[model samples]
Target: MFMRGKCIGCGCCTSRCNADALLYTGEEMDADKVLDEVFKDILFYRKTGGMTLSGGEPLMQYDFSLKLLKGAKEKGVHTAIETSGYYPGKLYEIAKYTDLWLYDVKIFDESEHIKYTGVSNKLIMENLKYLNATGSEIILRCPIIPGINLTDEHFEKIAELSASVSSVKKVQFMPYHPLGTEKMKSLGREQKYENCEFLSRDAILPYLEKIKDKTDKILEIM
Candidate 1:
């Protein structure tokens, strides 16, 4: 609902909603519209059990996120938020509506985190700890960018962090892909990581070894 960044802004999601509750606001959509569309699959909600709120970063638009989440809860919709855990204050406000928190732990080192994501990990780390303390169910998601933070040391750090957090129910590793390459060209933007290869099992196993026994944790490669 808190729309920011260069999304395709396609109304595909709105059209798929059977509830007839979705509306478009052009370049910027509304939280109300998102809630409406999501609730359309109330029957599916009854079956699968919840709705997810995710975007470029829901925390980017704080006020709308709070209102959107509160509205969803009032309607008895089980809620989850997928975020990078980069904004603590906003994350705290939305924690109440969140039944599950899908958090992306992108990088281990602060400097490298900034280099690729153009942001520091200080706030992200703070927010992760806060969410863990707030009793939110957490799934730690990691995008294993090929040339960035793909070392044994980085995985060790990640394992330590995962073991330290009592709320972390799982750790997911996602390898880089060229899925967004054409999108960059279509959008008139240059690809920053054209030379990087997708991570291989051989390349990843060593890193995983460094963190394997930190906890009896669920380690998945996707």
Candidate 2:
């Protein structure tokens, strides 16, 4: 039997059951419907912005993602993806259709990454390297969680990594907030990082200062 609290929302259970017994908690959207919605703001996209595919891991739905991106590109819409880089072998395929990649680089250490996210960083790092080699434009995003990954070493590592990648255009240091705590509660899931204080921009400035000179890419504390 599947235990309630143990579920990590990986969608593996839904795939394993041929009956589709596990209903999705979120609404399903089709590629055509998504493209229609995206095309609605053509002026906005034409002027300064474009569609960005973000997720619960967008690459998890690889076929739909590829189709969506290809459709958007055909319509002359710039495309971007906000990803955790956890997926296997498919990034190269998607890279061809992408304009900008807002890639997340959480904890630099391998063990700490597995401890917090329940996955090793090996795949993530490997994917990043592959993407970098392809000369794809990228923005490295790191969430600054207090007492978690908010450290000088983490910032330095990020800077070092970004510096090594010629295609990296920016490094975004995202401050952690408890904006999803209520959602977790509503889902009847325990809050893993309970009472973790939100890290302010002021708190993150020092780390930014330490790595600012290390990389030529724009460093934004967002």
Candidate 3:
């Protein structure tokens, strides 16, 4: 049911849909099937590779996500999740099986976050704090959305959180990429960051310098 994935810009499927209906994309896979797929690549997981549950917010499907992490852990495979931190799921239980948390820090200001993402950042902030308290190994994946959240206050807080949170293993700055723009256009829809240019490492250096002094944690631009 998730539409947030790979789409070639063929435009063949664009006209198939009716008025704003949900796209019938992404095959359904139960936890066991998914684990089977994950295990197929177990050889690569010898050192660096592992299972990461991503989403339109994986916590939205609490039962399936739980089953997945539990199964992966039982088989001695590493586990991680990339989450928005916006869902109210059983974090402690998920943390028990998860080896790392790739938590997104979209924006720092509450009003601005609500304006941009259509929700308050209260829950995200709360869950992040709770996760840190649980000693969950975390990577703060901060995306620098152009013309929206790329601000001084945002960078400063990213540094502060990186330095203060004992569980944060690293602060990763994700540059803006126009990967979704073409996919949206092919689907006869418009994206918010349409026409935005991809950011270069040179562009992220200033922000990195801003946070470098405040945080001793490892920082990398992706």
Candidate 4:
């Protein structure tokens, strides 16, 4: 049997199905229409925010993301991207069109990073270094998840990396919440962090203190 519908290419069906039948129903959007929507908020963007390309991983759709950023830049609008820095080769080209980068650094340890995210940190770290070398403006965003990555060592590593990178403008420590648990379940995926503790600003303060003097970059709990 064959299933025909909008798949979103999330790969949930492929993973859960006992039968090897699911295929990716590629995702697409009209570039002109997307830019039209982005340009509609030009006035508000000028005042505070700007065009930001984020994703399950924006670079996963490298061509579309590149065109989107390019179009935004051509329209004299500021452009930013929130990325996991997983694709170093694609990032180098995308970085050229981006004005600001909201880069995520989950954990510094190689094995632990792979254990939690199911991917190695080698590519992520290499891309970060590439961004730094190219002078791309970046803000490091780290999620402080209790019982997972909320540790003194994590913060210290972040501080050290931030300090070493000349392109990093700020370090944002994001407190993890289980807000997406229901959504994950709805999509036929397991919620690994369902019972995970949520760390408040106060809970993250001790970790922050460990790295306070290590980096001169602005640090904020968000």
Q: Write the per-residue lDDT of candidate 2 for residues 2-70, one digit (tens) a residue.
A: 566787888767868889877667657899999999999988898679999998888999999999999
| Candidate 1: clashing residue pairs, number | 0
Off by over 4 Å in 4: 1-28
All candidates: TM-score? 0.80, 0.86, 0.85, 0.85
Q: State each candidate's clash count.
A: 0, 0, 0, 0
Local distance difference test values of all predictions, in order? 0.80, 0.88, 0.85, 0.85
Clashes of 2: 0
The prediction achieving the highest lDDT against the true structure is: 2
lDDT of 3 by residue, 1-222 (tens): 436356664544645756636345566789999999999988888688889999778899988999999999898888999999998655888889989999999988899888878899999999999999888799999888778767788888899888888999998989998888888786667476775688877888888887798998999998
Q: How many clashing residue pairs, candidate 4?
A: 0
Candidate 4 per-residue C-alpha lDDT over 76-108 given as tens digits, one digit per residue, 9 for 90 to 100: 888889998888475667788998889999988
Between which residue pairs do clashes occur in model 2?
Answer: none
Worst 10 residues of 1 by lDDT: 1-10
Backbone clash pairs for candidate 3 read none
TM-score for model 4? 0.85
